[model samples]
Target: MSHVGVTLGVMAAIPALVEPTMLRWARQTQGYSVLAAARKIGIDEDKLAACEAGYERLTIEQLRKAAKAYRRSLAVFFLDTPPEGIDTLRDFRRVAGSESGEWSPELHTEFRRAQQQRDWLIDLLESEDTPVPTAWSLPSSEVARLSDAQLASRIRSHLEGLAGSSGPTTSDRYAHSSFWVSTLEDSGVLVLHTSGGGVATQEMRAMSLYFDRVPVIVLNGSDAVRARTFSLVHEYVHLLLHADGLCDMVTTTRATNPNTALEARCNAVAAEVLMPAAAVRAATESLRGRPVDEWTYERIASAAVRFGTSAEALLLRLVNLGLASRSLYEQRREDFQRAYVEQERSAATGGDFYRTKARDIGKGYVRRVAGAHRRKVIDSFTAATYLDVKVGQITRLAEAAGFASASGR
Candidate 1:
């Protein structure tokens, strides 16, 4: 073909539109290298570089491809500058058992999902005639030094009042944990569960983000139910202290808390709230009168059930209290963790999708979102987007949540 003929063909395909800056910004913000972005978009590295460098134009089709690859809408590429994105401001996690490193894309995706939940919750609350929700203020430095029993009582009182529960008598583990989720909601805290493929790494069991009054907790639902309970309380402690970051409850004692001070305080506080040391001591003392060497998983398991805590967390407390040998605790920890992981893996296979999704998005939040849709506070389309489901599925979710009047129902 002649030079003019080749130029005419290129011009016809390219449309003379260039968004070189926006393309570069999107790629960089997504942590993609030129080659990686090109591969993601199925373009040659040199060609993609040339397009972003403004040396050549990308066809409209190529622009669409790039937009999809970067996980951005086509409209974003037309923006003059990259929008300020969301991220957890700190790393409050103490990872001990997970092999996954740093932050992963999967984790960040869930973080954004949590943020979306928060945004929608705000909308729903604004539309309702609810009371001014109370936000828990952290104890003063002096009170922060209170013993675990007193601190645990304080946290228990606040959470129980928020949940509207009777007391610490637990008949069900799930029902008990669900109470925490509802309580968090009542207190202006956002709780979201991210299960299977939830965190970038399995090491990341839970994460929290404190945005002034809107504190958010993202728990790894893939962990044991009892573990999830501890995670919820751990994250609650983070919100109380306004220290938001990803966390792994690898070890609950001060040994796991990097610093001997703030981090330790958070872990100790979470431990107290979840399984008051006094409660554990009472349970252990009441155990069928066994010598220290005679203590076994069976006995500890019984105590754990009574306290509404995992055998692992309660056992660890035993080790910390010198009631059980560190060696014995380690042995039990290994056994319980292995079993917990297997149970989670088994449940992940052929699990109920909507139910799990409901759990991942928190039972309280799902009900409210579905309720908002039912009352026409928000349309199905908006509800679906916030719930991260197809528009048609919104109705089923609403029905499941007992909000049957919504068009989705």
Candidate 2:
């Protein structure tokens, strides 16, 4: 192969100078050490160190290898110096008495990736002339005027028509979460249900990010369906108010503080969405004639099933409606969470790539990327990069996403 003083063992080397500052910038931006970055790119540690120190230059081929390992383009290695990194998005998951941890590496990667996807779609929507999305940014007080029950009724009506759930019926674990996810997507909310890194221990339940006039929700796919469903609607509430942040409000609650008033509102919205006061009153009319003190775990779970909600959500509903005392509800919630954790441990893994990414990558996002590819707006490589999947899997992934969107619509 003809070469420009450098060889890649194939096509001619594209004439490019790999700036040492850029090399150091890329490695540092991703929080990688010299030795670690070298190992990642399969390069000699000493050689990489020299490049980063500006003592030696990286050949075009070596630069390409480094670029691939860093998940960046070769042109990035040619920057004059170092460029600033992506802006940090807002984090609104903090609640009183809870540790508000910063983003983990996996979560940070996923967050940045999601933001980039949002960026891509914003460009696409503008060029394609997509209609302006309706933002349900109502004053929280006004929404409460209809009473929480009435607002929930309206949301329920919206969700029922948002997507027609017909997959595994009540038997499947993903039934509830799938239903909400479809409904969310159908209502123009982009839902991403990945496990972030798919790591079990540090899995975040869900997070919402608003961008370019649209809201995107990311749910942890590895979590149990019960918990994921709670997260889904909780984030839906955040999206409604155009509030952007991360949260893990799965199976629990915190005291209402003016500082975290939004979390409280979103929490209430989630509870009402899943089990409104009207529905709760109707369902618990028989139990009410009895006594709140007599409510049992089995009873709460049974009631939860009717509303297609989790026992925790149902318990919260009961407490909010004063049908059950706070003391009893908390006690039952503790028991419920323990049992639920054990059940999740024994339950099978959530879903495979097709079922998971179908919702995880988000149907709204998948269709836009797929359509972009078809229109030559983006190539397969770019599509796969944005999807965090292999190039060959693009078509199948797109099909699954399309099917999901169609099912929801």
Candidate 3:
């Protein structure tokens, strides 16, 4: 049958049954909230929730509304064959709170879809003999139970062993940002740039075990460069604990409360992971009364350059170590941001590379699908859909990885 006819038929057969799944799918695939979906569909929030939970039936109007809302063809909703990689997508849906109703329909859906697509791409790349893993399946939950102090001790011990006389001297230069960023993605952290969102807003959302794959992290696209890095570290902590849900680290002006106990713990873990207190103290001592109170932006910038970190990071480290006051830190932050603005303007770029590069290179999602395809877990068409591209594009990826050309075919 035609794709449209198939979709309509699917809607007719299990219109009510698909409502919850569709609502959940819309949210994850497109980041639409339940309230928003209700508004779009002209249904009351409770009714919409009920509809999504499969407690109520959806009218033909509702089915059309949902199909449009989710940007999916009606046929997609009712394919006789589960779309080639439905399992991963379904797993993502399940893990991302599709069944429990924990997340706002939009966020839950977008994250799951993005993760599924990413995994599919990674799987495909692996089929072409790419060395990348399908996912970074870490045992985060086992480590998350440790206290902040215990985590700190563990990080210090790990660093001490990792840091040898011949190793890189700067605390800031441990590894290239790209290396860690890719590593985080491989570990099932769904990092993406928010096309639209507020400032100082980024999160390490909770893990979901949809389809039995490991948990995933979702970072906002709207955060500043420094904020994004912090978000990555924050989410890494969440992954370690095998926990899920949002951990918003943005400090607001409106006197918000501290994070939840678990979030606070994760924060502590993130700070320790990125900047060890002992390392900071030792680094500070090495400067030996360098008169941090009067240190200029140039001085801080120079130090950051030497340490392979941003000036903002160095200032924060000083504040955490009690070598700089809050007021001083704030002033330095303003100066650094101002300087950054001037430099970025001179460069005349559209956005920060770190913020948008992964999506641009298709590194975030494409690689995962490639990996999955290589593992024979999914077929080529499935890889194409997950990457949101055509089968030909998948072929190009294969060719790029040195596979025999399929161009003549």
Candidate 4:
């Protein structure tokens, strides 16, 4: 068959304007190769290669099929404009070829953004002239001394206070159990999510100029929700110390291991934030006659609900407080995790709730460029590149955000 004939046949079978851009994006985001995507989408190898090279037009049906194969939505595929300004393709190539120890582009970008954000935060604090505590006030060694349980409690308390004062509207932004607070040393939020796996996995985490405006740590939705919460608080302690760099506490399960000083300190900070030892002791004492040793999973769950934490967290607190033995706590944790997994499996869902850095930063940047486009503040190409999606998708997002309505577009 002639090239035109084959192309026409494919077009007739798939009428949608499925851009090869979507395929490239799937490859980048999901770490799939062209052959894998072609096989999964049932597209001919030559046709898929043409689509990636921008030599062939992709039908909307093909785009939807590719989206399904990539486990993403057509809407997400169209959300950002094409890559421009930065050599994203080159960067990815470098990362792919680099040494095993080298950080991923996402991690490198996050590290740079975090450094900038930390510097900005220091400047902000210094500029205030008020008697605010310096980032150095909390010593790293001292921070390292606190137990994980203690640190978790402190973080939780601080967040609870902030949430209470900020009210319900701020709840979504702050009440999110996943947060990082630490002294000024190597401190920043690391938000991650699981993708295409039932087990906890890291999808992407980055620091960007986009999220630098606020000390926010977003995670992927497909991760273990409780584990994500713990990591956030652990990183928050790092932030409180003004520390730099990234740590995958969830993968390491750092809080559970008390041998390492840094992990212990972070665990203490997380515990302090989530459940203050003093408070836990008081609560435990108040529940007189209720055998602390015989604390049931239901009881722990109830405490977790009351304290706005996970049952696993509550059990850990009980162990730390000597109300429950270590063995008992571990058993309960395993049991709870098993049940949680079963529950999630029963629901039959993929992906996670945590927002990736790209999605978060990309969305924010897109919104700004979209506004500029509507106000005639920038050109269409500028809008497309900044937003990282196609021009058509940019228009849709602008309309959804009411930017178009206000600008009479």
The parts of candidate 3 lying over 4 Å away from their true place are 1-62, 71-109, 118-175, 185-213, 251-258, 278-293, 305-309, 334-365, 371-378, 395-409
The local lDDT score (0 to 100) that residue 254 gets in candidate 4 is 41
lDDT of 1 at 329: 72
Q: Which candidate number maximizes TM-score? A: 1
Candidate 1 lDDT over 1-409, as tens digits, reads 9999998677647743756898887776555779988997787999989988989877777787887776667887877766675553566554554322455545656776787778877767877865435555555683557776677678888777666674454746677676677678767777788766545435577888876656788888766677777788877777766677777765644443343355566667777777776777887886536766556666676677755677777777777676777887766678776765675567555667787887788766777787777678888788888787899898676565445643444
- lDDT string for model 2 (211-237, tens) is 546677877876777777777877777
Q: How accurate is candidate 4 locally (lDDT)?
A: 0.49
Lowest lDDT 10-residue stretch of candidate 1: 252-261
* TM-scores of the models, in the order given: 0.81, 0.73, 0.59, 0.48
lDDT of 4 at 358: 30
lDDT of 4 by residue, 284-315 (tens): 56443476555666666555553445667767
Per-candidate Cα lDDT values, in order, are 0.70, 0.68, 0.53, 0.49
Question: What does candidate 3's lDDT look like per residue over 1-409, in tens digits?
Answer: 9999999777665644453565566545555677887887777888878876778877766767777776566666544333453323211112232222234434544554555555654455555666543244434564657677677556434433433212133434324334345555554444554434422232233233322243455556544444455566666665555554454553222322333555556566666665666666666564536776557766665555433456667776677667777787776777886875564356455744322433433354544555566666788787666655577677555444323332232
Error of 3 at 391 (Å): 2.4
Better candidate number, 1 or 3, judged by TM-score: 1
- List candidate 4 segments past 4 Å from native: 1-175, 178-220, 245-259, 282-288, 292-294, 343-388, 392-409
Order the numbered candidates by lDDT, best leading. Answer: 1, 2, 3, 4
Superposition-based RMSD of candidate 2 using all C-alpha atoms, in angstroms: 5.4
User: How high is the lDDT of residue 186 in model 4?
Assistant: 18
Best by lDDT: 1
